[model samples]
Every structure is written in structure tokens, then in C-alpha cells.
Target: MDQPEGLTAVGEEQKVCRLQRSIYGLKQASQSWNTHFDEVIRGYNFIKNDYDPCIYKKISGSSVAYLVLYVDDILLIGNDVKMLADIKAWLSTQFSMKDMGEASYILGTKIYRDRSRRMLGLTQSSYIKKVLKRFKMALKTRSHSHEAWD
Candidate 1:
């Protein structure tokens, strides 16, 4: 805080400048942001997950919703559509955010859902391909054998 570059202080050089607001790039900045997020989410009646602090869950009557936080990214999932919409609207009003509509990809994994069958799938095919290409192994093909090896 000792007088930022190009800004000259008339007084002692040893005196550090006081910060008017929470400054970014500082260690406490992230902590403060996370703490504020936790407080806000808790105010919405969402409880933090025990195993992972970044996860929060809210259950209202028969509806259940979950919120996952990864850095600045968020992934929300819920059984009740109305509950999900309400939560999204509330969050948008509180913070500057852009809704990506339905979630298709998250954390390098692609999501597939079949509502009628009630099946959900997570795939990393694209990620695996990229990794393989980076290592020059993308050209390799898997060998298929109908005969059993004895």
C-alpha cells in the first residue's frame, strides 16, 4: 500500500495508504467474496454442504434445489422447475450475472439428460480427445476382437 506507482505522497514514504474498499488481487479479497456469497445464500435458507463448502442446498416443502460453486462459475440443479426459476431470478437481482439457460457443459464434462427415462449422463469425450491430441495419441484407434482370449 506504500503509495502506488506514479502517485507521489507529500508525507512520509514509510506510511502505508489505507484502502477505501476491498481491493482485488489481495488474499483477503477472495475470502471476503466467498464469505459474502455464503451469507447471501444462507439468507435464502440454503445450507452449505458438509463435505464441500462451495455447495449449498435448499429444501422447501417437497421441492429441493442445489447450488454448486466453482470459482466464479455456478451450476444450479433442482427437481422443481418453479423453484429453480425463482432462485435464478432472485440471484440475478442481487448480482450481475448472465444466465446460460439450460446447463450443457460444466467443469469440462458434458451433461446428457433423458427425462422420460429419468437418466442422466456425464461425459468427458471431448476432454479426453483434446488430452490425447496434445500427447500425439489421438490417431490411435481401439482394436475390437469378437473372439475371446484364452
Candidate 2:
């Protein structure tokens, strides 16, 4: 690659610099990041899902954990709390990531969990509301004109 402006040496102007790492926003950045992440996660004994390349799972005896990847966002889910914490710690050492605690929302979907009942629910109500508002159909009251159809 050509030398960037303001970084060209006085006598080494003709010398091209080699990239030591992938730069963000480049065309190959996404692929480069995915490759690196896969290598690191696989080293930790995570197996990539055959059906979905973005999902990985790791199991040890009765403990199991899953890691979901989307672009730069990641969601870690599993039944074992200690395994999850270990994965999070390992990932932090591999990349700069902030722990958002328990996940409540992902991809515009709200997550509801009832640990006592072992129930989990997902809703896209917020996304649906946004779409309705965009199309100017988010009415506060039912219109009398549409009552016949109801």
C-alpha cells in the first residue's frame, strides 16, 4: 500500500509500508475479524455450528455454552454460569469487549426471562412500533371507519 499522507519519511518516500494488522472499515475487515475470532474461539474448544456459521457451542461433561456472533456484536448463552464466566474472561483477553451483564435486548428484540419458571420469551414489539410509526399507521385510537372490518 502507498504511504499515508503526513507519515512519509524524508528519504523513505519511495518505500511502501506493510500492514501489520487489519484496519476497520476496509472491505476485508469483516472477513479478517471473523477469521481471527474463529481461530481464537476454536482454541478454547468451541465448535462451530454446521447449520449456522455464526454460532459456536462448547460442551464439557454436563456443562454447555453457546456463543453467537453478529457483525461486531456477541451474545453468550448457556446453562452453566461458571463456564459462561470463564468464556467471557477468555474473550476479554483476546479482544476489547464490554460486558453488558445479562442480555435484555438483541437485534431489536426484547428478551424476557423467568428463571424460577425456566421460561424465556422474545418480542419484537418495539421494532413493530417503529415500523408502524414510519408508515404513519401508529394510531392511538381505533378509527370508526375501520370498525366495519373489525
Candidate 3:
């Protein structure tokens, strides 16, 4: 690897820097992170999903938990609250992370939940609004009425 611009020494300009560890934004960083994460999570008996490599699931008797990984962010879902808390605590010990409480939004999608109805909904209204604003169409309105074809 070529020496970084500002850190290059006058006499050692031809010397290349060797990386000791994976650095963020590097091409191998994500792969390294995923490999390390997989090993740690698997140690806790979590099974990586066959369909999606980023998803892991742990089942113990009646308690079940699902962990979804998106880059550096993680979204945890489960029926048992206690199990989820345990997983969060374990994750905190394993890596530096902050609990953002319940997930309201992720990846431009909004999450809505109704405990009373036991319903969950996902929407992209925020994304749509951003796109409309980007093209200067935020205030534009279109007629929805339709007339019989001649």
C-alpha cells in the first residue's frame, strides 16, 4: 500500500505501509467484521439464516430471538422480552453499541406497531417525500379523478 499523503516520511517515501488491523471504509473491513461477528454470535448458539447471511436466530425451548444485521446497525426482534434484554446485554459486552430503544425507522422505512391489535406496519412515506422534494415536486398535486374513455 502507498504511504498516506501527510504521513509520508521524506527519507522513506518509497516505503509502503502495512496494515495491522482492518480499518473502517477499507474493502476488507466489512468482510472481516462479518466474519468476527459470525464467530462471536455463533458461540452463543445463534444460527445464521440460510437465505440471508445477515440474519441470525436463536431458539431455546419456547424463547426465540432474531437478530438482523445491516452494516454496523443491528435490529433485534423476539417474542420474549427477557431473552431480548439478555441478548442486548451480551452484545454490549462483545462490542461498542448503543441501544436506540424501539426501532421507529430503519433504512428509509418507517415502522409502526399496535400492541392492542398485535399489528405491525412498514411504510416508506419519508423516502417518498424526500424523493418528491429532490425533484421540486413537494407542493405539486395531481388529480385522481378518471373520466370514461372516448
Candidate 2, 42-136: lDDT as tens digits: 99999999999999999999999999999989999999999999999989999999998999999999999998999999999999999999999
Quote the positional error of residue 53 for candidate 1 in Å: 0.5
Compose the digit string of candidate 1's lDDT tens values, residues 1-150.
678876766666677878766443676777888998999999999999999999999999999999999877889999999999999999998788999988899989999999999999999999999998999888654546623552
Q: lDDT for model 1, please.
A: 0.89
**Pairs of residues at least 3 apart in sequence or in different chains that clash in candidate 2:** none
Count of clashing residue pairs in every prediction? 0, 0, 0
Model 1 TM-score (2 dp): 0.77
Q: Each prediction's Cα lDDT score?
A: 0.89, 0.94, 0.93
Candidate 3 Cα errors over 4 Å, as ranges: 1-25, 137-139, 146-150
TM-score for candidate 2, please give it: 0.78
Best candidate, lDDT-wise?
2
Per-candidate TM vs. native? Answer: 0.77, 0.78, 0.77
Name the lDDT of candidate 2.
0.94
**What global local distance difference test value does model 3 have?**
0.93
